[model samples]
Target: MIFSLPVQQEPKKYAPVRTLMLYLTEECNLRCTYCFVKKEPKYMSRETALRTLDWVLQRNVSGGEYKVLVNFFGGEPFLAVDLMQEVVDYGRLERPNLYKTFKFSATTNGTLANERVERVVREGQLALMVSMDGGAQANRLRPMVSGRESYSLVRKNLPRLAEWARLCTARVTFTPDNLELLKNVRDVLNVAPVGVALCPVVEADWAGHEQALEDAYAELGEWFAAEVRAGRRPPLEVTWELLRDYQQRLICKRRPQKACPLGESLMAVDSQGNVLPCHRFLHRPQQRLGTVEASELPDERWLYAHLKRAEIPDCETCVARTVCGGGCRAVALDGGYGLNEVHPYHCLLMQAHMRLVARLYAELRHDLNFWSGLAQVPTDTLNQELYQLGS
Candidate 1:
């Protein structure tokens, strides 16, 4: 059925909101061959740490509703366990109310995760995003510092990891070699993670539309659907929802106007109090907005510039231009390195995302009345509708 715009336009719902990733340390212990973060031992100084937190808390002055997310990342975030504990512990004590709501999470290789780390995770209630490509071959690609493949190591530590996280996930990397094993890998590692997040692998070597990826997508979709159908409400975050909105704009010939939310709800404070666009945008020299050390949280004017900047030239004429915001900035930087055109994977993943999102959108539109309120609806769908009004 055609989704005609209703008589009174539904107010823009979810604007692609931002989540801040606080990089506590850049040093990493694992030698994942596919590591997206450029590894260096640069650690956050204590002073830098305090100031970064200070900036996050200041937004209370703005007096707005925001989802405050602090993502601890590192060569291994747990490597700086002492610093990690200190900041969160001190922040809670010092500033009782930092944002509207506070949420914490981390993505790690799980090599440094220990019982103490586990305790902090439980106490602080962190969302755990762990990395595993597949089984042995994936481990070969994402090996650890002690000459260990992460698959076995992460699997061994997972029981404790699962218990620590309110939610847990194995952040699998999908390269062509292991792309076909998407479901096989999940079955092999079979731990009760909060949910398995299916991410399209992007790198300089990512070949386009392999039969393996297609097969994997079909299998992965079925596997994920089966779990939900079986009443396992594990939360798997897929970009396909984002892709569908991207497609609707294309199909309906609507221009999207919502801006990239890098500096608004989200802020990335690198180990040195260096505020950046976000985690994915951190590594690149050009992308660094400013060091949190040099300035307080960015003023609205500066943030507006960063948020609205046409960093990627290709987005100029695209229908999904606004909400997608040319996809993630650092991703465009990394994958688009040379001629630096938009990552071809954007199109591929958008194809898949749009496919999934369209199907879901169809289902949701069928049950439209049942879904209401911005907070009540899923984020991906909200952003789609909002983009149309260029919110």
Candidate 2:
């Protein structure tokens, strides 16, 4: 009932392969306040997109895996759904003989879900995540380029988005200004059957708001635990991710590596075909790894230099090091901290989240009724892990 597998003598190692995010276009409908993308008129040419897909497909990145995850990223990806369709069609056609499968996903602002985008989502089985901040926060922080509220458009589109992709989720970027995390999550869940992923706005300076942020997450944790006890699987991503990581750590008896594997196992190609560590480093020319034209990926030693928590002097001694994994490199640097450093607030948040999850796991472990109720609950990985734990 605790939902953890008994420690195995020969623990199963979980090693994920590389993820390729195609920055489809630099153009977006809404100009989000915390957005990092330097909006421009640039769009990835069809040739460039297909060629970049070809480059990634041809290489066996670090070998081992036969599947590659191709994600459509953007200023807003749905604007370029036509190009997305082309790339997915090309990958499907060419990948069969190459012994590879392409798993597709996209992160959009949710304002542009038309029939074209729906077709690609259905045909390609693309998992879609709509960026929505819920209620007034959505309009205030993510207003359209024309300065109009975007909340109505995005809210209206959520049902259609959920219908198109079973794995549709709303990604809420939580900032200190909008501290009501649980309320926003509830608002989003009310609109659609999609999951809610509360991504903290780490780019903003959160020095004085540590306690507020921690309390917000704790409130969310309490509600999430209640949802579990009541036999409903809460569609909350942050808590789910924490449980998954904790479960892995228990099963494997291994500490996690860096939290953000940007330049390591994950890489992003912009509309201009220039490769970078991730979408967060989009317009910064200095962060460019190389172009798609190059046969080999640029060396990532410089990234690992600051990306690894073990190498960071402060993180080495920090209690949350293994769990936080040096936090997000982009977030650290964007918040005016050094590379390989985590914001002080982030450090506290991680500790609080882990404690919250540990308590939830302990509480549910002894609840026989809760364990039986799990039979009818739909979860992302609960059933799979439960089966593995039982075996």
TM-score for all predictions? 0.75, 0.84
Write the residue-wise lDDT of candidate 2 on 1-391 in tens digits.
Answer: 0111223323223233357778899888888888888778789999889888767754543355566777788888888889999988887774333556677888788898878988999999887778878686557888999999998998899899889884777877777788785544777888988777766665566778878876777777777777777767777655665665665566776666666556754678899899878767776677677788886656445565545552355666655544566666666667677776666657766676677777766777576554554443345332221111100
Deviating ranges (above 4 Å) for candidate 2: 1-17, 95-97, 247-253, 298-307, 310-322, 368-391
List model 1 lDDT by residue over 312-365, tens digit each. 555665434534544444565676543224465665554554454445444444
Distance from true location, Cα of 41 in model 2, Å: 1.4
Clashing pairs in 1: 14-382, 27-75, 28-75, 240-353, 257-390, 258-390, 258-391, 336-340
- Which has the greatest TM-score? 2
Error of 1 at 197 (Å): 1.3
Candidate 2, poorest ten consecutive residues by summed lDDT: 382-391
Report lDDT (Cα) of residue 226, candidate 1.
Answer: 52
C-alpha local distance difference test of each model? 0.57, 0.70
Q: Count clashing residue pairs per candidate.
A: 8, 0
